[model samples]
Target: MWHIYQFPLCPFSRKVRLLMAEKGIAYELQSARPWEGEDRFFAMNPAGCTPVIKDPDRNIVLSDSRAICEYFEETVDRNPQISGTAQQRAEIRRLVAMFDENFFRDVSGPLLHERMKKRLVLRQSPDAKALREAMKLAHDYLDYVDWLIDNRPWLAGSTMSLADLTAAAQISVADYLGGIDWTTHEQARAWYLVMKSRPSFQPLLSERMEVIQPPSHYAEVDA
Candidate 1:
């Protein structure tokens, strides 16, 4: 069985888990915190990142969320998340990068540092100003999502793709940290509800991080 080294709240790991579940790939979770700087995890991934997958039976090791997902997309061949015409695939990849890099940089990363890392590791209270700034950026990102939903059935195109999963992954983390306000973004909220109700998303919603708790609406699919 493939063993995934990840913590409960790592969005990148969550994205990989979602793809694996959608593709019916079986995996066992081995909770890891890269911030602790464990030598074993670093050996698997010199970058000291979570979401490293290893198959001891085959002695295969892989790291990096996008690379791991693409590896499965190529090897598993059951559910194709990056499928479509070449142009369509390009669009999907573009959106994935936007969510994974840009969205994380502006929204998810800040919330994680202020809300999660600060409270859990640094023993420091969250910065109200930083949290407010991140939440405001979230609104802008959600407005963009609203526009996308108004144009296409899904983020990238007519059907669901990695773009949708990638965006949802970041949003899920942000939401868990109480950084998301669904008010005034009806289209985006509706689309996110659909994502939350998916089978692959249920497990993620139910899992909890160490001490921090999500807002009440975080796990409620209809809320």
Candidate 2:
């Protein structure tokens, strides 16, 4: 069986989960908190990150979300290939990086760490100034997304790819924190609604962290 170590709220973990589901790959999910530095998990990945997948069938383990996804693209042959031609795939990679790196660093990391992580792990109050800045960044990023998807069928191009999954992963967490105001961006909201309604995304929408309740509209596709 494929074993996946993950954190429920982690975007990287969510990205892997969505990809696996999209590919119809079955795996057992094990929740892990890398921040606490668990010994066995650290052994699997010294970098100490969630979303590590151990494919017992192949007798190999992998770390890093992008590496794992790329490995899947290279090894797994399935319908609706996630990666396209070399040049198209490069654009997809670029957009994925935009979300995973730029969006995460500027918006998801700061806002989530302040609003969710600090309260859950550190047992401290959120830094209001940090949250304000993160929220500002989030709005700017949302406007960019609106423009990017204004014409294309997906974030990267005509087909749905890792770029869409990456952005969705981050947006899911933001929605959980009641951070996204979807009404402001009509095209982005339309795109997100389609994403949210997918079977792969349903389980993620239903996940509720202990002591933290998502907004009423979180799992509602039409909302």
Off by over 4 Å in 2: none
Q: What digit string (tens of lDDT, one per residue) describes model 1 on residues 1-223? A: 9999998889899999999999999999998989999888899999888799999899999999999988999998887899999999999999999999999999999999999999888999999999999999999999999999999999999999999999999999999999999999999999999999999999999999987899999999988
* TM-score against native, each model: 0.98, 0.95
Q: Determine which window of 10 residues in candidate 1 has minimal summed lDDT.
A: 72-81
Q: For model 2, give the 10-residue run with minimal summed lDDT.
A: 75-84
Give the clashing pairs for model 1: none
lDDT to native, each model: 0.94, 0.86
lDDT tens readout by residue for model 2, 1-223: 7899987789998998898899888889888988888899999998998889997878899999999998887777774436678899889999889999998998888867887789889999998888778777888888988998887889989988888899999988887877777768888888888999999998899888788888899999988
Clashing pairs in 2: none
Query: Evaluated with TM-score, which candidate comes out highest?
Result: 1
